[model samples]
Target: MKSSPLALGLLALGLLAPSVRAGLTAGMQEGKVELKSISQLAFGPEGVLFIADPKAAAILAVATGDTAPASGSATLRAEAINEKIAALVGTKSDDVIIEDLAVNPISRRAYLAVSRGRGPDAVPLLVRVDVQGQPELVALDRVRFARAELPDAPADVAPAAGRKGGSPRTESITDLAYADGRVLVAGLSNEEFSSTLRAIPFPFSRVERGTVVENYHGAHGRFETRAPVRTFVPYRIGGEQHLLAAYTCTPLVQFALSELKPGARITGKTIAEFGNRNRPLDIIVYQKDGRDYLLMANSSRGVIKVAAEQITPAAKSITAKVSDTDGLKFEKIDWAGVAQLDRLDARHALVVRTGAGRALNLETMALP
Candidate 1:
């Protein structure tokens, strides 16, 4: 969902100045580039790979060279998604851990990030799974990449290190989405001690900016929290475009697109709070039977489906925590263990979830 820049100078730039996009051929910069950790990812035009390496305190957009047109034919079939993935990563069925899933809009292929071992010794690998459920390593050789840096990112500090740390950054990129020629990223910030949403133009064609969004959690001034947004979608409500973002303790908030200027401190209008303890993982807006709905995937809880008819500019923010329905009707999918989800097409969604026992599986199913 982002990139890491060289120094703090570029991050301080405004809209008037233009700079050359930092480009890298994947394997060529191996010695100089280390993706210590990959928390979130998204794809852009011309096979551009947006990788969020929170541990390294930077985001890198890698040119993967996977420009083939997507089959766009029909849904893919993965008979035993987990077993196949385990074999490809050279890990036993029990040793495999599927972290996240994303479908490329252009290639229509599903990508999975997996860990081969446990704890700090685990090895992470990116696997490309096709329509037939076949898995292959996404080659990083000879690929082009760009970096965007977040200044003053909290360093990954070990408790025993006595405050001295590596890189002054350890923030995580919670979610990523690409739309309208820009990449939208949501995550927590260690430097500012607040949640942030960033809109970066494609191909590193311009400067990058980060926005600090604050919102009230409970009653107006009784209790408030600047929690990080877990996931979000760029959508239009009441004929006006906005960023519909979800935060921890699950508050659905909206910010008008026009108000997201750099250096502007914005307050989100909290529209709905799903529950007290639930955390949202991913959210996608879709249409069905000539009606619109907001499908949100959650953690521990279940998938929630809210009718779009309930979302409107007239809807007021929930200032107080409630026990029941909050002006909107919602339904939970019957299936459990759906850890990750994304829109595959108009009527289908690609999900990566825990399968039998401890195994993981990726499958496409009709929208609820």
Candidate 2:
């Protein structure tokens, strides 16, 4: 995600808010490869960390188990999990760009959000690729990923407009997640700030054709404009299923799964807010030592950590700003994607730094 000077100015103003206790500081260890551009990341079972390198046309994997290096040294090294994933779909890398990454907790399979072109002709798609098997890539549009049982649209919303590619059809999917045999996709628009969210109830490996579950416009609240929703993660709050969504143009938005159902009317009461003016590039939820944390990667702020408890709708803000005299502040890092992993007794994470060079640099941080 690229940040403009105007956006940075807004973030500086946001820092003026009341200060709170700064989160724990974690040791940072850089990765091996220089990632030109990364989309998203996820940590699989055991100690495997998966990174989506769209520009490189491959997925990078790192093992952060006992084999990791000692302290002060880079613990993660980028290895190509599989190359030419787009080729598997009979398309060349130039014709398709990988945009998002998701890992299924139950199936242990990784999914990629692929976009097909550079212009309006570009068709956005969701594909599931095997990380452990022969590494086959299958498009979700080919098969139903899940059962669709959404409410009927209001009579005011014309039927033709309610169909996909209607008045406000999404052109890109920025984030994806699979859980309980259902896939949640976050739609982003390059021409507009608002985005859409859809839930597909089927396995990625079997999706035959593209399906629409729900479309969220910005009419619900002040934070609900046509902002570019960059990431989405499924989080369990107080034992209830909810969705944590972040945008690059606005603050974060949270809502229950029930409220996100297709054709379901949602309002400010159904949404929770987080983050500041800084554009959030990616987000991940990790549990360490029985404690849960929300890790966010901001374009201007390297990585910000917040306790899960502070994510309530009542919280005044999402993160607390810290002072630095050595200029060792978050601005020094150009973060693209982030992931959290558990390696033995240590909690590890990998962050992809973009625009620095050709190879993807993975930074390992020790979780407190």
RMSD (Cα, Å) for all candidates, in order, is 6.8, 16.3
Ten contiguous residues minimizing lDDT sum, candidate 2: 19-28
CA-lDDT, candidates in order = 0.69, 0.45
What is the alpha-carbon lDDT for the whole of candidate 1? 0.69
Query: Candidate 2 local accuracy as lDDT?
Result: 0.45
lDDT of 1 by residue, 74-101 (tens): 6865655778877887668777776667
Q: Local error of candidate 1 at 184, Å?
A: 2.1
Poorly placed runs, candidate 1 (over 4 Å):
1-34, 71-73, 93-95, 154-169, 189-193, 205-222
Per-residue CA lDDT of model 2 for 208-254, tens digit only, reads: 22233333434333333334457767787666677777656445556
Q: Residue 15 deviation, candidate 2, in Å?
A: 55
Question: What C-alpha root-mean-square deviation, in Å, does candidate 2 show against the real structure?
Answer: 16.3
